[model samples]
Target: MTDENQRVDASHTPLATPGPPGAAPAAPGRARRLAAPVLTLAVAASALGYVAAVDPYEPGHYPVCPLFRLTGILCPGCGGLRSAHAFAHGDLITALGANALAVIGYFVFAGFMIVWLIRAYRGGPTPRLALAPLYWWGIGAVALIFAVVRNLPFGSALAP
Candidate 1:
C-alpha cells in the first residue's frame, strides 16, 4: 500500500493510539491487551484467597484424596490443597512440609506468570510455555522417585 493510504488506514484502525511526547508510540489495542493477564491474575488470586480462607487440615471441609483413601498410598497431589493453604497463610515451612513438589510447582508457575504478565503489558508475544519431552520425562522420573520413596517405610518424611 502507498504511504498515504497506510497513514489513513492506521489512523482509522481501532488499535492505534496517540504517540507519547517525542517518543515512539505503543502498539494498538492496549486496552484489549490487558484482559488475558488480568483475568489470569484474578483467577489465581481468587483460588489462593479461597484456599487461604478454607482450612484444608480440617477434616470434612475438603474431600479426602480418593487415591489415598482407596490405596493408603500418598499420591503426588495428596497434600496440594494443604500446601496451598499454608503458602497462602505465609507459612513457607509448613507449605514445604505439606508438599515440597507442589511448592516447587507453585514457584515455577508464579515465575512463568510474572514473565507472561510483563510480556503481555509490553505488547510482546507471550512466551512459549512448553517443556521439552526430555524435561517432561525428567520431571516424571523425579515424581516417580518421590512417590516410591515416600511410600517406602524409610521415607515417611516425604509423606504428608
Candidate 2:
C-alpha cells in the first residue's frame, strides 16, 4: 500500500480502545468519591473513642516513650496519647497541658479532614498540603524548639 493509503487507514482508527459495544463510559459514583474521606474520619473517630475509653495516665496502659526512657528527654510526640485522651474527653485545658503540640496537631488534622470531606462531597479533587521545602524546614525547626523548651526548667509549663 502507498504511504497515503497507510496514513488514511491509521487516521481512521480510534485513538483509544473502545469499551463494550453500546456501553457508555461510567463516571465515578458519589460513594466512590467520598469513600476515602469518610473512611479516614471513621478511623480517626474510632481511635479517639478508644483513647477516650482507656486511661493513658495509668501506668502500663501505654508504653513509655523510648526517647524519654533512654535520654530523659521529651520528644515532640511525648504525651501525645495523654493529650488525645484528654481531648477526646472534652478537656481542652488538660489536653493542652498534656501536650500542647499534640493539641495543635489535632486541630490541624481536624481542619484538614473537614476541608477534605467537604471537597469530596462536592466532587472536587483531593486536597494536598503542597507546602514548600522551606515551610517544611520551618515546621521541623518549630518542633525542635518545642522539644528543647519543654525540657528546660523555665518552660516547665510547656512540659508534659
Candidate 3:
C-alpha cells in the first residue's frame, strides 16, 4: 500500500481498541477496596443483630473464662464480651463493671470505624496512625497495669 493510503486519517478520531480476547482479566484492586466497606458494614450489622438477640451475661448462654477460674487471674481481654453486651444494652455502669479497659477500647474502635466508613464512602484517603515505639510500649504498660490492678484489693473497682 502507498504510504499516503496506509497512514491513519488525522481528521478521523481513532477509536479505543478492545483488549485481547480470552486474556485473563486484570486483577481488580479497586473492586476489592470497594467490597471492604460493604463487608465491614455487614459484619457490624451482624454484630449488632447478635447483641440484640442474645445476652452475653446470661447464664447458660456464655461460658466463664478458664483463666479467671484456674488462677483467679484476670487477663486484659477477660470480660470483654460481657462488657460489649452490657454496652450494647445501654448499661454503661455494668459495662464498666465487666471490663473498664474493654469499654474504652470499644469506644475507640467505634470512633475509628466511623472515620474509616466515612472516608471510604467519600473516596478520601485512608487514615493513618503512626504510633512511635514509645506509644506501643505505653499501651502494653497500660494493659499490664490494668491486669495487675484489677486483681488487687486497691483496684477492686476495676475487677469484673
Candidate 4:
C-alpha cells in the first residue's frame, strides 16, 4: 500500500495484545446475556414488594409530599405510590381512582420493560426509549397542567 493509504488505527489492538496492566478481563457472554433481565426483574420485584407491604395509605410509613403539605396543591407524584400499591394488588379501579396518570404511566413502563426483556433474552438489540427535547418539555407541561387541574374544584375527581 502507498504510504498515504497505509493508515494506522490507534484504537485497534491485535489479539494477544493485553489491555493496560491490571485491567480486568471482560465478563463472559453468558453473564452479559443474563444481566439485563435479572437486574430488571430484581428492581421491579423489590419496588412492588415494598409498595405492597408498607402501605402508602398508612400516614406514617411514607413521607408526605412537601409541596402538597405546604401549598395545599396536588403534585404529579402525590398519589403515585398509592397507585402502585393498588395496581400491585390487582385493584384496577382503586389504582385509577388514586392517580389515573400514574396508573397509565405504570402500564407504559411495563410495556417498555416487556419489550426490553424480550430483546435481552433473544440477544436482539434493545429498543431505545429516548424522546426528543420537545417531547420531554411537552410531558412536563402536561404534568404541570394535571397538577393545577387536580387542585381546582371542578377537577377534584383528579385529586388523590
Q: lDDT tens string, model 3, 107-152?
A: 8878877887677766677667779999989999999999999989
Lowest lDDT sum, 10 consecutive residues, model 4, at 13-22
Worst 10 residues of 1 by lDDT: 8-17
lDDT of each: 0.85, 0.91, 0.80, 0.84
- Give model 2's TM-score versus the native structure: 0.85
Q: Pick the candidate with the highest lDDT.
A: 2
TM-score top scorer: 2
Per-residue lDDT tens digits for candidate 2, residues 54-137, read: 999889988999999999999989989999999998999999998999999999999999999888888888999999999999
| Model 1 local distance difference test score | 0.85
Stretches of model 3 off by over 4 angstroms after superposition: 1-34
Q: What is the model-wide C-alpha lDDT for candidate 2?
A: 0.91
TM-score of each: 0.80, 0.85, 0.72, 0.80
Q: For residue 62, give model 2's deviation from the true position in Å.
A: 1.0
Q: After TM-score superposition, what is the CA distance of residue 143 in candidate 4 from its true location, in Å?
A: 1.0
Q: Which stretches in model 2 have alpha-carbon errors above 4 Å?
A: 1-26
| C-alpha positional error of residue 108 in candidate 1 after TM-score superposition, expressed in Å | 0.5
Q: Write out the backbone clash pairs for model 4.
A: none
